[model samples]
Target chain A: MSAQPAAVPHLEIDGVSKRFGETEVLRDVSITVPRGTFLALLGPSGCGKSTLLKIIAGLETQTGGHVRLDGEALDGMPAYRRDIGVVFQSYALFPHMSVKENVRFGLDMRRLDKAESAARVDEALELVKLGGYGSRMPSELSGGQQQRVAIARSLAIRPRLLLLDEPLSNLDAVLRKSVRVDIRELHDRVGTTTVMVTHDQEEAMSMADQVAVMAEGRVLQMGTPEAIYERPATRFVGGFVGSPPASLMKLSRRFEGGWRFGEIEWQMEPALARRLDAIRRIEVTIGLRPERMRLVEAGTEGALAAELRSSEYLGGERLLHAAVGQERIAALVGGHLSGLPKPGEPVHLLPDADAVMLFDAENGERLDP
Target chain B: MRSSTPLLFLLPAVALSAVVFLAPFAWLIYASFKTQGAGSLLMADGLTVKNYARLVADSYFAAAFVRTIGLSALTTLLTLVVGLPVARLIATGSGRAKGLLLALMLVPLVCGALLPSLGMIHLLGPLGVVNGTLKLLGLTTSSIKFLGTTGGVVLGLVQAFLPLMVLPLVNTLSRLPRDVEHAASSLGASPLRVWRRVILPLAMPGIVAGAVLVFSAAFTAFVTPQVLGQGKIATFGTVAYQQAALVLDWPFASTLAVVVLVAIGLALILSAQFDRLLRRRRLAA
Candidate 1:
């Protein structure tokens, strides 16, 4: 279910800005995660997504801004008092502690009765499917198992908000998929406000109901996964969110009734031409997803000529890597296609007219159609 | 042959150490069993257990042994209590602060036992800087008896060997991930609870290592105890020094030295056993 903003915000990170000396790590970033929403702060390294997560978890203090949990301002609250559970990228399981002890740590801090604590530990471990691993030390578990134990440990606390920092990054590819599913299912069952920071686009798209795409210390876009994928607000978001990502090329020259990029020409519709004319931009960037463009025979009419560089087989589909001038673009063509060019051969790409996105060349912001 | 080649290469060093070090140690053990004829410094022909018998029989030596053990234990504990925070600061601090703290910690270590012990004299002496400051501040009308006291000797020993505790602690604490503490905190552990549950448990190896090192150092320490004790506080080391160098009863002194060496060796073995026990599960895992 989609989280509506009209509902009371379970976690509100308002204008949180963090600076380490002169370097601004997070610049006035803000996000409101509604109750029971699984939100992903998706970005590459040094994008301030992890920093924002830390600020919310109270592991770090924001140089400026207020973070409120259930409308109560969490300013000056130590991480212990924040009642937030953080599952670190490394898992951060106490190596000296047994799985049971690690899970019971928060309960022990609460001074819960032995029977109650033991029951809680059992419940948490069962949730993570590690029911019989109580007496084992953290060092005894596999990476995936350790990750689950970390999740179990955090869940044992029944924390108000749960923050996961790149939770599945350490796991193998196969384990990552399974663990990702487990985490999503756990979140659904737990129904706690969850925020996961990850550089993985697919992880965000698949697991999160809401995804906030971040870049260069700023939130570029925040919406449902579909909205983020279908309509990225900036060129950065457009290039970042897709698999075999969208090919972006800057087009400058304007011909008779279309835009010209070196030897390639994109004929504009009458309505689109009027919009472009109104903006009066000499240079504009265009984005095209790999699946939206088809590989045609060289010298085809209205097709952009490209030099085929490589091809990768992907079972039912093959990816064609081609270069149009200096810009490299890929086409996800069917493996059963009739014609496929060898590396270094000339090819033509025919793009779907309606799927093309226009962006401002200077700022990389998407221009409205 | 290839594996044995490395051992063959190690032969020279082993042989040199055996000749230079083990030979003297063997003689020391042998001498501990011999005794001198009356009014003579030269060792007598037949071996006797009188030296060890004297050590076991004398209540004075027993008291000295107990006092020495107590002082060493006290020094070990004091250094641990004081060094834990300093080691943490060095481990967690960055850039200039870390470098500065490390350099400060190393200064006394490089200065050696005698120099720092001398420095401690000025700091803890009755008419020294502390007493002078106290007198100036009108805190006391008379000088406190810091010199030739158990407290004075222990203070000197702790000051001399705190780096022993801190170095191992820093090595361990630095390797300890900050995330572990954060996880504890995030799991509803207060700062104190985090220390008790996570930090102290993880730092056990460092604590044991530092304890052993500081204990061994203080147990056999001569210069600091002798200088700071000033002949009034009779520790095992001070008594050993008095017997060997001042009393000139080489055989009796050698027996005392052997006792110290045995005690230190036992401590090492005990600590090694502790380490093995801690590591058994880890190795199996």
Candidate 2:
């Protein structure tokens, strides 16, 4: 049974800041995590995402401000006292303990009776689908199995908040996909407030209910994955979140209520047109998702003339690379489509107006489209 | 191909071991059975058990054997008790502090056997600095006698071999996975519990190796016991010295040497078994 629900937010990070000597690692970062939600702190490496996770877990103390869980201030509280479960990137399972003993460690630390601890250990192992491996040593198991033992060990305590730091990074590509789904399922089954730190954008988009994009030791944007991918607030987010990265090109306004780049000119959607009006003829960067660019027949009037550069056949989808003037761009095409243009062949590249994203060239901030 | 190249290089070492160690040990066993009173042992008057019987009948030899074993056992135990905490501190302490402690531990090793024994005698003698300090502190009225006792010999032996016990332990403990300790702490285990459940079990191999080295060194120790024991406490090595040099009984001394060899061989075998057990447990964990 759950304890009485406290009045405070399930997890509240207030004005958290951290500095390692002269280097400012995290600056006044804060977020409120609702109970039973899976939140992913997604960023590039050296972006302070992992540092913030450690701060929330009490493994690393903040230089300023505080963290609270269930109405209790967590400042000065050691990691164990905070009653949070953590799965590190390295797994960190005790090499001297069997899978069973490792899972039961937290329960034993809580002074649970032997019978109760054994049952919980069994349940935890079953939760991670490692029930038959109770007597095996950590080193004897495969990497993924060792990771499962680590997860089971953390879950044995039934912690209220689970903190995971790139928990699937150590797995191979195939294992990472399956383990990612397992982690999401585990989160759903426990219904515990969870925060995961990861540099893998797809992992965050697939596993997290909400994604917090971080860069340069600060949170640049935080929203659902749809918001993060579709309407990224900063150029960094737009460039970072998508595969083949949203292509950015310099564009200027034409006199006839459309945008121009190189030899191409096209009418913009009215909503996007008004947003570009503020900057009028001044040059700006336009972001087009790979899926939003298409190859049309040459001399299609508004479309830009381009030359095919390269193509990669990726099982279900073919990634086509092309050049429009001096700007290199990519388009994702169906893999089964056979009439592909060869390298150096002229083609027409057209942009989907609704999917176009505009940013100020000087600062790379998203324009208000 | 790569593995066999190293094996070929190891052949010389194996051949040398067969020629040097095994051949001599076989010859010693043969010599132990030869008759030796009337003439040279090279011309044996038939193989006999007389040397072994003489060794058993000698009371002084028996006392020395028991004393050597007891002293070695005590020294090993004391070294373990003292060295384990120091080694753990060296392994886990801050970088500068660990370096300083390591340097301090090496001082006795640099001083070696003779100088440190002389230093100990000066400190433990009747009118020595220790007695003078005790007198100044009003802890005693007269000097306390420490020389000519087993305690003095043990103190000397421990000081000489302390680094042997600490270094191996520090090496192994320092290499232990630090993540294991953090995992235990994050699981709500206390610091003492973490040490008991994680650190000590992982460090058992180094502790066993240290114990064996300390025991063997103490068993064969001559100079420190000679200086500090003041001719009162007899050990197997001292008895062998008396037979070979002072008494001029080469056959009897050789027999005593054989006994020392057997005792040391047994101790090494037992220590090896302990090391294996520790290794297996580490792997199981």
Candidate 3:
């Protein structure tokens, strides 16, 4: 995630920066991915995640940085000289070439023996579960099949590093789920240093061993998927990771005994209050996971009171959205629950103290626990 | 799904083709079969193969036929050689730059044939800028006489039809997704290999369109060959013009016209097969 400085890491990216004219797409980013690790660069569009992957793949030149593959400098090495594999978002299969021809291209480029190339192409196709699809043109195949062909085409050369750029974005939700597993399986079988860039957090969490969350030309945080989910380094990371997302309660001033959100107050521990006293009049933001916030009976003691606004049935569970003062908060209630909040009804919500996440009100930086 | 016969909608186009193209072409074909009756008359009852026989027996017509195909093929090749890279550059350019590049490419199309033919003459003719500059540099003393050469006509034709090549090429190459090239390059294919193994094969349709357009333009060319050839280099078009105007041999002229038209038609039809053949060769390699 960060600079591991291991005994020759697989891929070492040192302070890479990319600038196009006046705009800086990536600013001074560095990371060391261990050998045989699956890393995901997770970010929204325009966050420079794709650019970073392209740089690693040598498809793009970094404005200023050094990249090393197993401790060898990548400078002055053209794309053809670098042993890298890239699966583009569009699947970029050659429409004119048959799947076998497409897969054999890397072998032809390397000028490998004809017999060897054929065997590798067959093996790569079979690895992607596209064994009999060798003779079909890319246009004749479905989207999923084309994606697998692209994967096979890259893997045929036995690349030193594999980069996938939003590889499953083009597939439907149902297809995406299957292809995601295929990618993970392919990674497990190849055991190469793989870097994938995707906008979907669920995809990164499920597929990658290490996830680097990027924003505004910077890596906000890089950690194990569990670490990223349980303890996000920044408020953006916290808000971006979870579905139905976390609810933010804005507190301008802290009372003598408790944290106050307008008229609502939650009593604070002495040690916790002492730790939070460093900040003055500036607002404090508390992030509570929606699932961790339970809906209780109205007028319950030590609970935040809110008026129910709406309820949505989500097949597995129903979600209740309620208004606390001017802000809106949502909570999921499991099926077969006894009581459900109805619109215009008063509801009480309780947040676990240990599950509360604190962040700076303005900058969105996570305050230490 | 509830529509009437589709031929009903196509009847207007069919009628137009029959009146404008089919009728005239049929008459031209019919006239090409007749033999000379008297001094300057064409007789319909002869129904002879004499005109076609003349085209085969006479080396003058044979050379003209070869010249037409050769020059047309050369022009198409030269245009693709010069245009593919420029079109690729234009395709990769930003939106505004793309518009500007397209406008610049369209200059020849907008100005018509006369301007470029004249420009070619002024640039490459005997006393033109090219020879003049060469003379001043002490490279040569006399006129280069490019005015009546096949090279001059080919250059003139390329100028006339280059925009045709660029238009479809830019359209096709721009619509092509760039990720394939990236994938190829990342997979360790050199730039040349990427172009040959990926870009070129993928761009075959555009190449065919550009080649056909440029070939047809150069093959049927009259003014450029008339002005540039200056009666020295004879093509099917120039020979047909001469047979019709000077000798007043209508039958032979029709014969030359039909042969050139059929050759063009064959080239267009065979180009699809040529594309498939090229694909097969690449796959084998």
> Which residues of candidate 3, in runs, are more than 4 Å off?
A1-7, A254-257, A263-282, A299-301, B1-17, B35-46, B133-143, B275-285
> Chain A structural similarity (TM-score) per candidate?
0.94, 0.93, 0.93
Q: How well does candidate 2 score on lDDT at residue B196?
A: 86
lDDT of 1 by residue, B1-285 (tens): 787998999999999999999999999999999998788889989999999999989999999999999999999999999999999999999999999999999998898789998889989877899999999999998998888898899889999999999999999999999899989998888888888888887898999999999999999998998899888888888899889888899999999999999999999999999988878764444
* Candidate 2 residue pairs that clash: A95-B285, A96-B285
Q: List the pairs of residues colliding in candidate 1.
A: none
Residue A201 lDDT in candidate 2: 95
lDDT of 2 by residue, A147-174 (tens): 9999899888988788898999999999
RMSD list, candidates in order: 2.2, 4.3, 3.4
Instruction: Show model 2 residue runs off by greater than 4 Å.
Output: A1-7, A249-273, A279-283, A299-304, A324-326, A360-363, B1-60, B89-112, B115-149, B227-232, B275-285
- Cα deviation of A143 in candidate 2 (Å)? 2.6
DockQ of each: 0.65, 0.46, 0.54
lDDT of candidate 2 over B1-285, digit per residue (tens)? 887998999999999999998987776677667655564434345877787898789787777888899998899889888998999899989779999999999998887789999999999999999989999999999988889999889988888898989999999999987667777777877778888888887788888889888988898888889899988999987777787788766666677777778888999899898888766875665
Interface RMSD of 1: 2.3
Please rank every candidate by DockQ, starting with the best. 1, 3, 2
User: Between which residue pairs do clashes occur in model 3?
Assistant: none
Put down candidate 3 lDDT per residue, A146-219, tens digits, no spaces.
99998898888988888899999999999999889889988988887799999999999999999999998999
Worst ten-residue run, lDDT, model 2 chain A?
A1-10
Q: Which candidate gets the maximum TM-score versus the true structure?
A: 1
Select the stronger candidate by TM-score from 1 and 3. Answer: 1
